[model samples]
Target chain A: MAQRTVLFVLFDQVQSLDVTGPVEVFAGAERHTPGTYRIGTASLDGAPVRTSSGLTVVPDRSLADVPDPDTLVVPGGQGTRSPDPRLTDWLRAHGPHVRRLVSVCTGAALLAGAGLLDGRRATTHWAYCDRLAREYPAVDVDPDPIYVRDGHVATSAGVTSGIDLALALVEEDLGRDTALTIARHLVVFLRRPGNQAQFSAQLAAQTARREPLRELQRWITEHPGADLGVETLAARAGLSPRHFARAFRAETGTTPGRYVDRIRLEHARRLLEDTGDGVEQVSRASGYGTPEGMRRAFVKALGTSPAEYRRRFRPAPAH
Target chain B: MAQRTVLFVLFDQVQSLDVTGPVEVFAGAERHTPGTYRIGTASLDGAPVRTSSGLTVVPDRSLADVPDPDTLVVPGGQGTRSPDPRLTDWLRAHGPHVRRLVSVCTGAALLAGAGLLDGRRATTHWAYCDRLAREYPAVDVDPDPIYVRDGHVATSAGVTSGIDLALALVEEDLGRDTALTIARHLVVFLRRPGNQAQFSAQLAAQTARREPLRELQRWITEHPGADLGVETLAARAGLSPRHFARAFRAETGTTPGRYVDRIRLEHARRLLEDTGDGVEQVSRASGYGTPEGMRRAFVKALGTSPAEYRRRFRPAPAH
Candidate 1:
């Protein structure tokens, strides 16, 4: 088989992993299937490109000198916030010719700016998702998935999800067995399904706004065993339950029930990590009616069981 | 709280992700808890250190200028094969003062070469595990775990596992909740428990050596539905079942039964990825008599069920 050329575009201030993570996966794929992928990097002038972390990358070729690539990778970083028009023009000119076009993190912004992702479902770093959506209304930005692949263009959520996206590409080109092998070699999860949410309950909690709602949130967090139903929370907020639910959802972007559940789960997680309490006791203390109820909540929220969560997150005994 | 200083030792030819993955985790931790971890990079001369992938990182300070760090990170790549004496000397001089000493990939070689890992349980990248063990007999090298923590010293296997090690550090310093939040923001698995082996069934199959055993392995792979018992495999290899089992283990470092099981699981995984087969059909085709048996094997080997594996690895139909 002819070697598939994978050309990674290097630009000023690119996130180091946004380039390296996917590149490593492709390199691993080449190792698994010798002579399958010919990896290279290109820059505007073939000079060293400085990364966001003050790292500099030497590109293999200047954009003008490089041959058409089978796969074109554009990584995101602080650079993507204000991309050089030369780079965007290069992508606009060359992106459609590539068999596959991929963006890691805020690289989606560059692609969208280049008109490559217009009207396409895409994603970027969770923190930047709203900005991406607001900036590029033509692009359907879905922030949940680790990656979003629409047609031949793909976009990953953040830095490390680039590896997941590249693994999926390897799976498409080689096979699942090969992808799984590479994933194992990397010691990452075999595959993080693309649709998995990018934000955690804690992250959601951290985004709480409105003093009344924030105070209610803090109260709920501190008193997980308290009756945190909408009626009680609404009363605490000095509003009717219906009004509080709407106001909470509008301000927090989550329903009252979801907010309470997340708070309870966060409390339960802390109990699991800091204390040696068993599942039933912890569940009850966290306001879950039973161990089964808490287990369901854990699985629904974290895709892990209460026991597994505790096993994974529980603090090790100090020596 | 006094901010903990994490000094990442940048060297020529360092794998870019090996530095960025952990640095990002620490940076995320700082975001979660401001003034918690102060991250910086240092090089022997405090110059721009070129990484293995032709990326160069500008270090924050030289060894002479930087204060004693709470944590010191050494990353590895091509440069580790023959580390510069200047780097090793610096490590030897300063390593003991660091509260936590860490290595990613073959950076363990530098640690071991510096005599920092003498008589210590350590690990490196799987590909370099044997050499690490052979070269440093005093250092007990176990390559299975994603990251191995021995006292204040920690070493992670391969490049990406650096994030896992860093997350473990964050969990230890802050809490599991903080680590999980960082992991979620990064779009990586919440926590890959440290002990997870860095090899998959497909990786094992690819490592097969010796002609007769290789042929038998090929036959087993081709015929996953066939009875791949020791007796059948031995007949094919023209040896007694017991002798064949012993020789197989000697050559492959795994028992015949385990090898067959791995091959079957690999086949099952392929089916899950490629075909829209039900769990029962895939189970039967992969020589697992029942779906329950297949489920058990999948859970044991991959920590996921067939359905979940399919959901993760299966390609989405074209829109």
Candidate 2:
């Protein structure tokens, strides 16, 4: 197999994780399997770039000096909201050389700005998915995916999700065994796809702001355990129960009750994944009346109960 | 409460994930309670240290420049086998200022060599656990722990276990709610403690290496589905069935039949975590006579059945 080279682009205020996570996974792979892949970082300009953490990185190449890349990776950060026009244009110029054009976190915005993501199914950090869709009307924004790959372009959600996408790329370029080895070395399960739900407080907030049931939805997110009747919800939204239900489905793509349940479930999942809270505490905090209630909701929506989900999704603790 | 500062000591060939994974969880606590903690990185010398991935990281300070740190974090690498004398001296000198010293993976080796882990319970990367015990007889090595916090010093099993230790530290310093918030931000559950077994391949390999049992163990790992009766196993090892059973226990610290079952179950677990292969296939591949047999084994050992184990352990799929 030809040795694949990755040209990782770095810049000022870059999110350290967005670049490093994938770099670690791939680097670890190379460490274990010597001479299989070669990766290097480049800056648009030759100077050192300071990341958000204030750590400076000196890239091996300036964009002007970079080798033609087999894979081009663009990592996102707080700076993505107002990216350099020169950098955007550079991305546009360089997009076609790579077999895969991948973006991590809000880096999708840069790609979108460069027109690389136009007409492509893509994702960014969940917090900015809507903005990406709104700003680039041609881009098919999928907020739910951990990462997405369409044709030669790929995009991932948030900082750490890039690791997932990179692992997949490694698996595709090499094989499953290589990917699994890397994942084990990194101590992560292989990455989940973009179709997985991007459930969060922010996503719930977005769902609550749409038409016909905005008031009811807002009330539900705030008071998840409330037993508001359909009639009461409709009256709060100033529509007949029957009409409100139809419009709610049209606008939010889910029933009012089911939508409420989803918000609650999201909260519950967050608690489970993030806390040592027992099933009962998480259930109550998430507006489930009891542990049993939370379990049923989790089983219904995520195809796994809360305890099982926690076991699977819990982040590794740091010392 | 006095704000605690964690200084992660970086060196050439340092494991990137070992440092980054824990730092992420520790830093994330800021989301819940801003200004409560400070995180920084340091090196023995001020120059950038090349991580095991060949990527260079610029530390916040050199040992000479670092303040009196509340916590000192040392992560392991291939370099641990032959550490610089300067780095070891620095660790020895500053070991007194550090209220809590943490070591991840083979970082335990450095601590042990410094005499910091002497007479304390500690662990290193599973592959090196025996070596750690052999070299440092004064240290009580808990090979099964993801991490162990004994007195003021803490050590964790390789790589990802650092995350677990970091979360525990957060919980200790900031309280459960704050730690939970950080875990949520990082999308992980609170720490599961040292009691939870490290789920990796090294343990299986370690278990499969005893005399008289080694050949059968290799066979089991190589052919997970074949049913080998006690008589067959004894014959294969050139011993009478009764004598083989007694010798296997003496040699391996486990009964022969149980050892075989463990190998099969461990293989099933790897399959469950690494593949989308269903329970039946995993069972067949892992040398369980049937899916039901595999399920029973999973239930007995892991407290979860095969399908449920997969749901809880499988890495999320990459898109």
Candidate 3:
């Protein structure tokens, strides 16, 4: 079979992994199945592009000289703070010809800025998801999944998620077996199913900023199996449930129910990581009434199950 | 609190991720806990070093001018093929003063070449494991876990596994909660609690190269649930059990029992990844007589359980 050319666009301050992670995936796939992909790196002026981490990348061709690619990869970094018109203009002009379009980390912002994702459901780095949605209101920003694909365009969240996106692309191009081989070679998870929320549990926990609410939040985290309903929490804080819920949302930017869910999930994760407890034990210990309830919460909050969570995070003994 | 200095040594043709993955982990840790780590990059000549992927990295300082680091990191790449004496000499001379000595991927080769890994039980990228063991017989190359730490000297396998090593380092320096938070932010597995053998199942399957033996190997993979004892396999191959076992080992570099174990493990992994079957069902289907038997196999081989494996690698529903 003829190789599909995967052209990676480089720019000043681009995240090194945003480019290299996907590149390595494709390169690894090629090693597993020869003639699978032809990888290339390109820049605007054929000059060395300095990455955010002080690394410089030499492109295979300038945007003007490079041929139309089967796949186009745009990586994100601090460089996304200032979108280059030349690059965005080029993407707008050439994006349609490309069979697959991808953005890693905050690169989705560039695609949004280029008007390619005006009505597309896309994502970016978790830290920048809110800004991307705010700046490009036309783009349907869903800041959850490691990567999202609407039609031929795909956008991944954060730095490492780029590898997940690339692995998915490899699975799509080759078969599951081939993709698994490449993933094994890379020594990454065969596939990190679900969205990117697992990475944001900490961010969610720190939302409550008020003094009483902050104290309550700490208590809830420390005692996950406790009755953490709005009424109980409000009573603990010496306020009415209705007033406490409203104030909590106003201060934390999230509802009381959502806050509890996040805290419960965080506690559940800690239990799963530190212990070898069964799902039922973990669910009850982490505040859920039943294993089924906790399973639902895991799926809804982290897009995985309690049993699965323990499997992925449980610490192994030192060899 | 004073931050510890983490010095990453860069060289020409270094694997980009081998440097970036760990660097990002420390950087993320810094964001989570300010004054945690001060990151620095250094090179032998102080000139910009070109990475294997055609990227160039600028070092913060030359080795000659840089002060002794609290933690020293060495990343492997094609550069390891030709050891630079200056870098190895520096490692030998100053390695003891560094609080922690670390290597990522084939960087173990560099460390071993410097005689620092002498008699230390270490590991490297799986593909290079045998060669690393052969080249430096003095070093105890295990070639399994994502990372290994003998005293303050740490080493990791492959490129992305560097992140796992760095996370472990962070967990050691900070606490589990902080490391878990950093992992969540990075959207990586809080800790991928298994060895590299999980990733090398396919590699294990392809060891036999001769015709009839290779054909028999394929048959074993196809019938993983079958009785794969040496007696049955020898009968199938029209040879005495004793002769068959010896020939199989000589031809494939592994005993029949070990080969059968690998094939069964691979089959189990595939079933875990592709289906939602219960552990008992998967065990039976994958040739194990009981769930406990399979569980022991999983724990022994991958340092994880069958249920956990299924949770991690199960296919996501199509978007």
Clashes of each: 2, 20, 2
User: Candidate 1 — which pairs collide?
Assistant: A56-B56, B13-B52
Top of the candidates by DockQ? 3
Candidate No. with top TM-score: 2
Which prediction has the highest lDDT against the true structure? 3
DockQ of each: 0.36, 0.32, 0.43
Give the Å error, residue A34, model 1.
4.9
- Rate residue A91 of model 1 by lDDT: 92
In model 1 chain B, the worst 10-residue window by lDDT is B197-206
Shift in Å, residue B148, candidate 2: 2.6
Whole-model lDDT values for every prediction:
0.81, 0.76, 0.84
Give interface RMSD (Å), model 3.
3.0
Which one wins by TM-score: 1 or 3? 3
Candidate 2 versus truth, CA RMSD in Å, comes to: 4.4
Query: Tens-digit lDDT track for model 2 on A1-319?
Result: 7778888898897877778788887786777777777989988887778876555667887888987788899999877878878888899898977898999988898899999987789988766877788789999997766788899998887777888889888878777767867766665556431123423334444464565467667677777656656777888888899998888888876787777777787778777767798888888878788899888777665555676677655654443
* Reference-based TM-score, model 2: 0.84
The C-alpha RMSD of each candidate to the native structure, in angstroms, is 5.2, 4.4, 4.2
Tens digits of lDDT, candidate 1, A1-319: 6899998998888887788888878877887889889888888988888776555556777998998899999998888888889988999999999999999999999999999999899999887888888888999998777788999999988888898889888878897677877776776655564344424433443445678788777788788888888898899899999999888888888887887787788788778878999888999999998999998888776666777666555654443
Ordered from best to worst DockQ, the candidate numbers read 3, 1, 2
Residue B147 of model 1: what lDDT? 81
Which is the winner by TM-score between candidate 2 and candidate 3? 2
TM-score of each: 0.77, 0.84, 0.84
